[model samples]
Target: MLILGQSPTDAPVGTFGLVNLLAFLCIVPLTVLFAPVGASLAAKLDANRLKKVFAVVLLITGVRMLAQLLL
Candidate 1:
């Protein structure tokens, strides 16, 4: 991916860190803007069904984390 005497990683550490920080910074506002919209959509769906699905997913994640910790 190098051209014109430049590879992407040739960028300075500070420059790369700043770019990454800015990218994450942008996600904050986006989450704030979309939170209410996503909440409304989920609310319109069958709440009980969604809750059951979410509970199963959470249980699986918790089990996996515990297994990893025990190992």
Candidate 2:
């Protein structure tokens, strides 16, 4: 986003800062609500199982991003 703002465009440079601030503001409340649930889930899940799940999720997300670009 910062790089895009740096390019020749109509967008104001402060747009990056605005986006970052908005993202932070939006995430803080969600973190507060979900962190406890995540922590509890982590406690229940085996470490190896969590690692595998995280890896698969990341792979799927990467594939989805690539597909988006291709499509």
Local distance difference test, each candidate? 0.73, 0.77
TM-score per candidate = 0.43, 0.64
For candidate 2, the per-residue lDDT at 1 reads 55
Off by over 4 Å in 2: 1-21
The numbered model that scores best in lDDT is 2
TM accuracy, model 2 = 0.64
| Residues 1-71, model 1: lDDT tens digits | 12234335766443343254455568889999999987887888798988987899899999999999999
| Top-scoring candidate (TM-score) | 2
Q: Report lDDT (Cα) of residue 44, candidate 1.
A: 83
Clashes (N, CA, C under 3 Å) per candidate: 0, 0
